[model samples]
Target: MKSESKSQHVGKVTHHELKQTLGTWQLWGIAVGLVISGEYFGWSYGWASAGTLGFVITAVFIAAMYTTFIFSFTELTTSIPHAGGPFAYARHAFGPTGGYLAGAATLVEFVFAPPAIALAIGAYLHVQFPGLEPKHAAMGAYLVFMALNIVGVQIAAAFELCVTLLAIFELLVFMGVVSPGFQWSNFTKGGWSGADTFSMGSFHGMFAAIPFAIWFFLAIEGVAMAAEEAKNPKRSIPIAYVAGILTLVVLAIGVMVFAGAAGDWTKLSNINDPLPQAMKFIVGEHSGWMHMLVWLGLFGLVASFHGIILGYSRQIFALARAGYLPEWLSKVHPRFKTPHRAIIAGGVVGIAAIYSDELIQFGGQTLTANIVTMSVFGAIVMYIISMLSLFKLRRSDPNMERPFRAPLFPFFPAFALVAAVICLATMVYFNFLVAIVFAIFLALGYVYFLLTRHQRETAPTDALLEE
Candidate 1:
């Protein structure tokens, strides 16, 4: 933990491993999951009765808005796709304070998401095996993933490759059932009755759905966190970014269309594992045993959780090395060559979330879910800021080397910025209260940085000042 000379890599930044371990395919597997449609569980806001058009509008808006945001991230990530992701980018573009807020939000978001995914795994497992206790299922899944992450990235990547394949297979199987039983009338009429309409009673309900829908599409940028591990970052990073989004877009459309046509879309509303339930109705238990579908879906959950923990730990490592947080957190296990401190820290947060769910009577699931939602909004805010940073950096350092340039330059980034703003505007529309929560989170991070200014003396921060 000793400080290095300013001329040295004081951030404890070391290219300690070969980049060949991560290629375009591995990176995409780690970032995108075929079953992330679980995110849309709560998407049924009071708009469904507005008919098929409303569903399509929500679906297309999410897809387009998210793609634009990912494009903006592609530029930042390719430039400095080191471990910290946004934390690193914000530091370079806007200095320490900006870095701290973005890093803090990213850390909280990552830490919370892993357990949430674990819980999701439990939900699916319970649906699949009615005898399994929900809490036990959750803890068992968490324990399994905890080990998977600690075993080292090589093992994690291999596990990712396997589960990703399973995910794709399961998606195709579900698609097969849905395609043949497809009833276009189910989608065209009465499919959206349960959602909130634009009326006064359900205005907030409708507003809340925007952030939830947007949340499903926000984490694709996480693939860039592995830039330091990518075989050829300049080529692999952009491919991973764009490719991940494309995969998600196709999967999302498939799920939405099938879900709409196969069942009363109203029933699918607000349920976490709507696909399996919909599948049961579409193909009946005989086509695929209900047990098999449920377990397969749980496997997808585990795959996503594993990837999430890996991506998030690197963000923590980047923040630690840059001196915004404790230096020990920057350390990598010498043998495993992974961010050990960040991994453990992420585990603790995951455990805390489990306890919070157990101890709170005020609907911990709902609250935790909302907190995660707020985290998603926090990401949107940072994205909007980051997109602006892209324009500013291009103007300020036009001469800087960019190994992978964003296509169409300012136009694409500008379009992304506008989409990000629309996301924020939607957040404000849906729940000003959640917007306030994100604002408070940002303010607290800034204040904590002020209180921690003394730690800067011996802390490594060269990365913050890097060109």
Candidate 2:
């Protein structure tokens, strides 16, 4: 039998280890899976309520910032090339405290997102069965993916690829129906609300939109989490980041335009599941087919939850490997070679969110806003911290070699950071209950940070598995 290496895989006493390395395509699929959640259902609602110009401008900024941010992360991921990408990078550059903060914030961002995606799935399901219980739908959705994950990592990765393909097909179909209705006049009729929060003047509206926009663009960095699994981390990971961002950007622009032209921007604005409503208005009685389209797109979106759970599971595994989290969390299955414990942890969170919402009647209560805002707000905090880390790393570790550098150096990261802050301000300005909930999460992370600080310091070297 092959002897196990002396390197500790974090605190847990385990003979298991990570299985096969992921290739470029799989890495890209992970990134796509993360951001694709928003494209299918979230974006339309966020942008539609604003006028045509509001939607278009928001789309433009989202596309631009995301493209630039992908490039920035490409550099960071390449420099670190670890499983827990940002956390690993932050730790290496800024030490354990910074790493913990980044990891904690990211954990909150990713963990919170599954619920948002699951809830969206529940919403889409409600279209077919108007009285469908969200809790049951969410639980069902979570259970299906959790089972797929328990099957093994390869299945989870392959599933993500399938989800991406299906999402592409769904978007193309949506574009086909709505693209023809595109009218330049629609875009010229309205302007952004210009609400204030971050920036100095009239652009406050744009600034305020920043946080939610960041939320929408949050998952594009999934390449980092699966970096260790990549067949060739240096090549495939970068390509995936770039390709996924480009594809999402183009698709987002198309979707925004399509959603705008399908009907009056005014009417589509308030509907959370806007595509179905827009299609209903456009195709009249044939809206059933449109509903079918939404249902199909929703399937792809839900499939993404499987990929997300997989990505985050590995992150927790990495965290454990680094001795920041419990060693048991970092354990890979001896046979399946997947991080079973981390997967379970993530699954628990996903199901719990589903179950809690069911019990509290979250959709029927004021807490619905709390649930939605929590994810958005968490993402905003993570994005801001990640960007800030970038600046700090540049200053502190000027000598660190960057295989893939952020284009325009300080300028792009600076701008992206500003954009992220602006988005958070917008959420607050809009009085989104989600923002308040996000503050609560941040406070929670802070508390967790303080609690974990001493433990991290005293963490034994044996707890860190170098391999």
Candidate 3:
């Protein structure tokens, strides 16, 4: 392996590689933390669109998609082990244009996700202190986490581990606390999109709920973005991804079900602080349990918020190193050996999005809901391209060493690919205006890529392959 400081030049682009400092546990922490915030909030919006029963059906379908997607995506991550994640796979499979589409979609997914998490952090804080503006708290979270990420991957990942553990524990406590109050009647009331039985309306609601259902495991794929930073990616990534997905599936279903049954399901839907608000139904507004939930809930939001800052910075650094973005953003900090410029650059974009909550609205959705849908738009696109890349590589590079092949081969990847296509279509149908906004973002990014074509350097296929 080359030194972290080694730079390879191609055309006008130079790559500044990230250090390999992460282990299996740190990778697991990151995999879970990156998506834990969805459990904290953002997902309850599904209840609003699909009703509790309808959303459960939506969530089950999406979970199956992610389960297959992660298993297949791990193959590409272990084979390439590049910080570019899907970009490297797509580039190797279909050349520079494929890389650009995958990279742009990934950037949108990672960059937009943090602002929504930050806002949720603010909302959690606002519950404790009513006078604090959610946007102010959201902006403050970005600054604090960005600094932590800029310091180093090890420290950032360690913090993510601690917070993720706490968040997981708190969620368990929540289920136990509310379990006594749970009733079959409350859960079934207005369950099928406010109808007595399933109908076309119920199906439409389920389709509309796709994005929120997706929130359950939105950025687990981000574990791949840290492939270059892992001590032994082929071995560690598989363990982390497999364990992370199982843990999340159990937690997502438990949290959603228990929260719904604790009280009137409708009240828990469409709110940023659903857990605490649901707890208030059982423990009362002034109870100690309610206070604990309000405080500990921040850990869940923080885990995802901090971990994603780590995810987006690595992505920005990779994109810049490959000349898809400005070269200056690729510079690693000399002392910390981290992508400081990329961390701060992503922070700027997220902070701007935090301020835009009031300025942007689509289909009468809340800022968090709209942003979640937009991020899912990027995610579904990346998933489709990534699965295609997996198939392409299998056919094009028959002899490539694969330490961890996706189980069930074509069956697993094909299932994931088909599900991702269905999700993208459903999301676009329900979120047409937000889809336009997402398309505009991609169009602008593609235009930038075209203008800088002469400066771009595609990383070699064998550059980061492990021995």
Top candidate (lDDT):
3
Q: Write the per-residue lDDT of candidate 2 for residues 1-467, one digit (tens) a residue.
A: 00122223246443535665577787777788777766655554444344455555676786676776677767788777777867776665556666777787678767767876777678667867989987678778877887777677677888888878888788788778766666755544453442212223335444444444554566777668777667777788878888888887787777767776676666666556666666665676567667667668775567567777776787788777655677678777776778888888887886787667444344233334445556566556666767777777788778776777888988888887877776667767775544555567667766766566544543434322232
Residue lDDT tens for model 3, 23-110: 9999999999999988988789888878999999999999999999999999999989988899878877877678889999998899
Compared with the true structure, model 1 gives a TM-score of: 0.88
Better candidate number, 1 or 2, judged by TM-score: 1
Give the clashing residue pairs of candidate 1, or none.
45-195, 45-196, 46-195, 46-196, 47-195, 47-196, 48-192, 49-192, 207-430
The parts of candidate 1 lying over 4 Å away from their true place are: 1-20, 34-52, 128-132, 191-207, 286-289, 358-365, 461-465
Q: What is the lDDT of residue 353 in candidate 3?
A: 82
68: Cα error in model 1, Å = 1.8
Off by over 4 Å in 3: 1-15, 357-359, 457-462, 465-467
What lDDT would each prediction earn against the true structure? 0.67, 0.67, 0.87
- Per-candidate TM-score against the hidden true structure: 0.88, 0.85, 0.94
The Cα error of candidate 3 at residue 191, in Å, is: 1.4
Report the lDDT tens digits of candidate 1 across residue range 1-467.
12312334445644423234777888888767522534334444323423444546655776777787777678788877577888767666676666776787777667766666666666666766899976677777767776776667777887887887787677767777777778887766543333333344343343445665665565667776777788788888888778888887887677677767886666666566677777877668666455566667665677677887787888877776766677788787777778877778877777666667533224333644755566577677777767776886788768766777777777777887887787679767655665666677678877777777555554554542465
What RMSD, rounded to one decimal, does every model reach?
3.8, 5.2, 3.5
Predicted structure 2: clash tally: 14
